[model samples]
Target chain A: MTAFQPDCAVVITREDFSQDALQAEIFACGGSAGALATFVGLVRGAGPNGVIEAIEVESYPGMTESSIAAIFEEAAQRWSLLAVRVVHRVGRLEAGEQIVYVGVSSLHRREAFAACEFIMDYLKTRAPLWKKELGTGGAWWVEARDTDTEAAERWGL
Target chain B: MKIDVLFFARIREQLGVSRLTAQVEQDITLEQLQLCLAEQHASHWSEVLGGENVVRAVNQVVAENDQVLAEGDEVAFYPPVTGG
Candidate 1:
């Protein structure tokens, strides 16, 4: 394997997101003058129709990165995307904290938007992260949502 | 033989554990381990490993029945993942 791999897709976690880093990444991919779209997933204070106190995210250390990278590769093959980025946080996170980020750049706005949505759709359904909801009553693991599966199936993945 | 068992998602919450180390029987099959776990913790394990809906990954890769076991292998069990 190459020591320094150039990924059309990048995944990371910092104290917070950096606009400079994101912009640099877009330029690094030689994607200037193109439209860039992003989606920032936040930890919500509610679950499926209920109040949530906190949400815990968990993932297999070695497997999560590989899975996310694989999804990025598949999306690149499916869309006319120039660059993409995905970053997710683990451990105890409060509401409004950025849980995940997906960014896509393309020459056309349509492609940028489509690819960003595609990546998020795939990630929501396919990523190996697990979530637990803490609410007034107690804490429980959130069940897999059927709507998410349907959204992913719409993409034929 | 020693094997590392991992739990994720709802199963982890229900069990209140993320991982466990087990000394399973020699030449134990994956199915056997599942059954063993279910037997050990009859109440919760039965629900988590109930039937065919549960997902299993061996060594971080999705696995099926008949997957061979070895010492120091990692086996994980969880409900279907719904992440993005």
Candidate 2:
């Protein structure tokens, strides 16, 4: 099997985020002339309708990594992407915590922008992670939204 | 045989269990497991696993209805992911 790419995608616990990893990823892309764009998704202590008390995320270990790798590969094939990074956190998270990050570098802004968006859309609907929300009365699982499905389908995946 | 069944996010909250050991028929398929689980819960499980869109994973890999099973495998059922 091929070695995992250092700057491609990562799934780790919240405590593992480091400045060094981010910088190393940026440097590894070797895109001095390209524009780098990033998107960071934070956890909000609420669901679609109300304030969220807490959220729990779960995933299938080996499968999660493979699926994410495939998503990145697809994104790379579809756009003029130079480098892409995706980091997702699993476990208990509170409001305002970073949940996922997507970074892309390309010769032009369009590919970087589109690749970032595409990775996020694929992650939202296709990834195996699951999330539950805790609120005032009790805890509940967040329902799948049609909007998410639509966004993912827009990529034809 | 003993298989690990996992529920996550909403389904876990609803069922109130994270994982459990289940004894299912040999060569069980994902569809059969869902039906059996639904029946075991007096059909309450149907609320989560009944629909066509619900997703399943076997041994940490996303699977379809015809996926085969073996002892000691991990099976998970949950709704489509919405996380970023």
Candidate 3:
């Protein structure tokens, strides 16, 4: 067990996030944890039409932070975690740009991996954020997928 | 009672406005507010708010249509979230 970084668990911003910086902050806590897992979500270059241009990400200001906090709180309660971090970008992001980051630290690899995955699944479905894909054809709001809902539900949420 | 109603993403584009205040009877359920907006704005608002899966929130909390609303509460209606 080590010092857990729960205060920085949720970050919703318009600026791009640095994965290395986030990882550094997590490990800087000098925890006895043996494993750290991270996931980064990027905007794809391909779209339903042709090459994608950019995507506009939108979120509810007050609710977005609260939602992320609630999600990370659940993960911390579910596992013996050392640290958890989530950085989600909201604004106009070009294709291939980094969109999100989810990281978890724990004493064992299994909890680290499970908590990382769990945070991502819940973030996708619970966060009050939306995306609109822009491309040659036109811009359209990305619809919620059933697969994401199923992913979150699998955790008994 | 008056409450602030907000629209976001696709719903904001469809409505051509980000937010508006509505006056209604006290203790209106979330669903009633939607119907009232649809009734006031007619087809334009109806088509957008009438969707089966439109997400709603009260005072920044994800809420059901049955949730009771109070004066000065903030209500939001939008499409299902797609953030990663």
Candidate 4:
């Protein structure tokens, strides 16, 4: 008989992440996970500035990690998760670059899918990170979207 | 009491300072601290900090304006989060 040790990691970094590496981590966890779900957000090229050249992400160092960890904690409480990983990039990122990633693994497909979306919803509204879009025309801070708030609220958390 | 104050993103750029130390009275509410800072910096800061949607935190937890402050606490102000 073997023990099942759940794995969870939250990272806020300036460097890029490898989806294959992250997925491999989940696949290697305990060998009990039957499903894996992942989400990757990218820097878009279009905005109010017409054509965004890049985005500068800013975050409160300690709070950023803690807040995302809290979101993962909540997801764990609601779902049967075997593993979870979140990586969000800070500082300057060019268009089409990956900005964030959320991955979850569970005993079943449903749990993995739900936990991934749940973590992302909470992270969008609760994490202490902000984005500023820089374009050829000018630069502006990205505004909080009501749709995001609504999506998070739908979870009733 | 004294506390460290932090600002991020647009608010940091508007204020031209990322972090600062504030001298405050003992047992000041977060709201009171904000008002004190606004009073010291005047109109520009008042306008920036007074925005209805400005988010605040105490000791790294999202906090309401009425949250009490203590010495050595870290307080942060910034726009609502937009990350995924």
Candidate 2 chain A: 10-residue stretch with minimal lDDT: A1-10
Point out the higher-scoring one by DockQ: 2 or 4: 4
Per-residue lDDT tens digits of candidate 1, residues B1-84?
999999877777677888889878988888898888888774877767764557788888778878989999999887777555
Candidate 3 on B1-84: residue-level lDDT in tens? 999999999999999989999999999899899999999885889889978788899999889989999999999998888999
**Candidate 2 clashing pairs, residues 3+ apart or interchain:** A45-A52, A46-A52, A141-B10
- Give me the displacement of residue B65 in model 3, in angstroms: 1.5
Residue pairs of candidate 1 with colliding backbone atoms: A123-B84, A124-B83, A124-B84
Docking class of 2: medium
TM-scores for chain B, listed for all candidates: 0.88, 0.89, 0.94, 0.95
TM-score, one value per model: 0.83, 0.82, 0.94, 0.95
Cα lDDT tens digits, model 2, B17-53, are 8888888999988888888888888556777777667
> For every model in order, what is the iRMS?
1.5, 1.6, 0.7, 0.7
- Model 3 over residues A48-148: C-alpha lDDT tens digits? 66777999999999899998888777777778888788899999999999999998888899989999899888778878899999988888888888999
* Candidate 2 positional error at B74, Å: 3.0
Write one digit per residue (lDDT tens) for candidate 4, span B1-84. Answer: 999999998899999999999998999999999999998885899989888889999999989989999999999999888887
- The sequence of per-residue lDDT tens digits that candidate 1 reaches over residues A61-157 is 7777877788777776766677777777777778777778787777779977887888788777776777777788788777778888898899896
Tell me the lDDT of candidate 3.
0.88
Q: Is model 1 an incorrect, acceptable, medium or high docking prediction?
A: medium
What local lDDT score does residue A50 receive in model 2, on the 0 to 100 scale?
83
